[model samples]
Target: MAKARLMVVEDEAITAEDIRSSLEGMGYDVVAVAATGEEALRIAEKLKPDLVLMDIVLKGGHSGIATAGELRRRFSVPAVYLTAYADPATLAQAKLAEPLGFLTKPFNEADLRASVEMALYKAGAEAERQELIRKLQEALDKVKVLSGLIPICASCKQVRNDKGFWQSVENYITEHSEADFTHGICPACAKKLYPEYFDQLYGKGSGGTPE
Candidate 1:
């Protein structure tokens, strides 16, 4: 498996470096470190890290909660909030951002590792669930298309779709499904359409092998 990429958003330079060093020591790739919410958003847009370690309080126009919410809404990136204030009011505001985990100040390396691992696992599972749902929806759509009673012209071999427009069989199927077509002429069609080239094309009495 690939290493999980991480971003750290902290206003304190020493604390941010400590977090970066700890995360890197734990085998995660610390892609970028931001000192403010604005920098976090800019870096998140460009790096698209797997997860972010966001400080709940920042010296900027956007708070960590607001930044995390923006990240989730725009880039689908999850955050693990780090803060010294774990009061009821702070927790209430933090919940609005829907973080993956919360770590109080002075957390140990073991706690950090556990939170990061669990968050990454949940994110991966959610991504897989979404992919499965998309595939199932596509399969259901294909079944609906093929199960319907299609109107086809017997002479022209054209199909009439739900929009009441006549289209070639290839065109209709291609539009409705993931199937594609490559042109080919069967022996019967070849004989009727191009008699002069039929014998040459089929290798005449040479058993379908050119002389």
Candidate 2:
């Protein structure tokens, strides 16, 4: 199987390299690393990583939470927050970004592995679900099922559409549904309309095949 691609968004160079080393050891591809929220967003736009390991506090105008939100909105990328500060206020703001997982600062290899795996799994499942919904909607859109009461003329055998305009049965059905028409003369109609060739064509029976 292909390794999952990841991006590290940490302002500290040493911490970012540590995270990258851990991820690479865990069989994940660290595609890029960014030192600021703005840089993270810029790299994410191009790399479109499967998951982002983001530092919640960074030295930039845009916070990690704000950058995470933008990554999700623009590229459908999910995030696993890395933070030393897990205070209630910071967590409250982080929740708005809907991060898939969280790893406290000074985390071990096992903690990193767990958080990254869970985030990748959830992101994949959600993407599959969205694609399934899109396919089902497309199928429903393509199907045209006719229903409800129809107003049709008894003598002419034509139908009245929603606009109150009368049309032939074949034309109405063809327009309102996936059905198409192929013209053929039935035995009774053929005998009645062309008596001269009835016996030769139908073998003198009510519903006979052409000889």
Candidate 3:
């Protein structure tokens, strides 16, 4: 498997450096680092990193959560919040962004490794699920247009579908396709079958009435 590409976004220089070092040591790419939300967005658009470790507080007007939300909506990248505080209000705000993971500050190298690994795994699983659903939908579409061997009788217009069964045209169509049938009389059949009733239904010599 390829190593996960990571972007570190922290306002504190020393903490960012330490995290970068730890991530590199754990075999992650550590593709880019940003001190502000704007820088993070620029690097993310360029690098398209697989995951982002973003500090909740940043140097610019846009917070890390805001940047992460934009990345997710536009690029569909997964992010984990790196913060020193985990108060309920802050955590609730972070949760609204749908972060992959949360890591409190003063964490060790092992903690960072575990958190990153779990976030990448979760992202991978979600992507796999989406791909599976797409493939299933495609298969269903193919099945819709599949032309099977349908048996038909020479005398009557009825057809024999799969399973060696005989049924009316409407019944066979409704069973094989996602179609709903409504009963109605065509102009030719209505005029031939019910001329007197048709005149009674509508005015005299009117075309016909629907069944």
Write candidate 1's Cα lDDT for 1-211 as tens digits: 8999999999999999999999999999999999999999999999999999999999989999999999999999999999999999999999998999999999999999999999999899988999999999988876634556889999998999889999998889988877778888788777788989988778767665332
Which candidate should be chosen as best, given lDDT against the real structure?
A: 1
Residue lDDT tens for model 2, 111-147: 9999999999999999999999999999999888899
> In terms of TM-score, which candidate is strongest?
2
- Lowest summed lDDT across 10 adjacent residues in model 1 is found at 202-211
Q: How many times do residue backbones clash in model 2?
A: 0
The total of clashing pairs for model 3 equals 0
* Residue range 112-178, candidate 3, lDDT tens digits: 8899999999999999999999999988975644275777888998998777788998888877777
The Cα RMSD in angstroms, rounded to one decimal, for candidate 2 relative to the true structure is 2.4
Measured on C-alpha atoms, candidate 1 has an lDDT of: 0.92
**Candidate 2, clashing residue pairs?**
none
Q: Locate the minimum summed-lDDT window of 10 residues in model 3.
A: 202-211
Candidate 2: stretches off by over 4 Å = 205-211
lDDT of each: 0.92, 0.91, 0.88
Question: What TM-score quantifies how close candidate 1 is to the native fold?
Answer: 0.69
For model 1, give the RMSD to the true fold: 6.6
- What's the CA RMSD for each of the models? 6.6, 2.4, 13.9
